[model samples]
Target: MQRLPSDPFTSPLWHFVAVLGINGETGQLRPAHHFTGILAGLIYTARAVVAEAALPSQDRAAMADLPERLAAIRKAWLCKSSYAPMGYVLNLLLYGKKIAFETGSRLAVVWNRDGTLLYFQGRPLAMETIRQLIASMTADAEDLLWDGLLFRPRKAEAEAEAGSSSGRRKGLGLLEREGRFLIPLATIRDDLTQTQRGQSFLHTNGLLGKEKEML
Candidate 1:
């Protein structure tokens, strides 16, 4: 697969596993959405500080010296998270990776036990989302996301269709509103294989296997 950019600002928001939350009363750590919210929140705070600092002297003076305050805030914030540096935090967010803040001080990329990246920061990072980001980054990789010139189905939708076909539709598995195209992970692999083959056909007008296409 073509490489995706690590920038989070422009990336699509994907589904992610929530791993940390802020304490309601004690202000301690609680299990919450993956670190995406915190990461975005921090970035927003930083940008806001910078914007406020750019205002007239009276306004800026009330907030303290711009450079000193930013530096202090950066220092304190950086010290709190075990996450990557601010530069990387921005990059990861741009690329749509799920970020999880471990505590007030540490942040890290969330990964599935099998190592397939899920949603960054409690957002869903589905294959379609990644593929879209990749398409935005590179022209040559555009075809990778097209199946016979049509976009691939979202994961939840495909699953609902499959479930309906199986004649066993009684639960919310097939009723998930957001992920209408969500399919079982197993079907994802199969659909991907077919999608690739179809793309190859559209691009070359001939059937081809992976090795043959590589040649």
Candidate 2:
């Protein structure tokens, strides 16, 4: 299982991507993308986001309002969500888990229960959409989504009893425990930022936004 490579800045016009989290001082943002190599929009921090990355040369006109637009979106996400920028590792982990659980494993558009914030609207994340995108990758693209891999029919059957017989788990006649089982994987800030493809995989994919914990 692996994330497909994605380059979202193809269009001359700026492509809008929602933010998942951010650091206030630095221009870094946690971009929202599915398995399109953006870390499921779950918990990967991106490098600085700018229209300049999309354009071959710096076209001032194309990026004139990028800063203002980014600021506005970041502000909105911070106000309504539980993610805090740069420092709080706990908030980052909770938010990531919440998104993955609610969205059922694919990195798609997610919102708070109140409907004030929306995520990954740029691509409209869904199973079919994800399947189509993966097919576009290569002839033998494998699904790298954590949840899909975790709950696959055969894999689940094989690993249902993988862990200790008494460990807590998710779907197997009240006895299923596999892979991570009860051991929490996300304990520090680095856990959220770490990626199988290396830190570079966390880049914003040429879109934008992040912020502080409000809940």
lDDT of 2: 0.37
Q: What does the lDDT read for residue 127 in candidate 2?
A: 57
Give the per-residue lDDT digits (tens) of candidate 1, residues 96-154: 44323333543445555655557454444666567667644642232244322434333
Q: CA shift at 111, candidate 2, in angstroms?
A: 38
Supply the global lDDT for candidate 1.
Answer: 0.43
Misplaced by over 4 Å in model 2 are 1-41, 45-61, 78-215
Query: Pairing residues by index, what is the TM-score of model 2?
Result: 0.16
Q: Candidate 2: minimum summed lDDT over ten consecutive residues — where?
A: 206-215
Name every residue pair that clashes in candidate 2.
2-144, 21-210, 83-212, 84-212, 84-213
- Model 1 is weakest, by summed lDDT over 10 consecutive residues, at 11-20
Cα lDDT, model 2, residue 101: 56
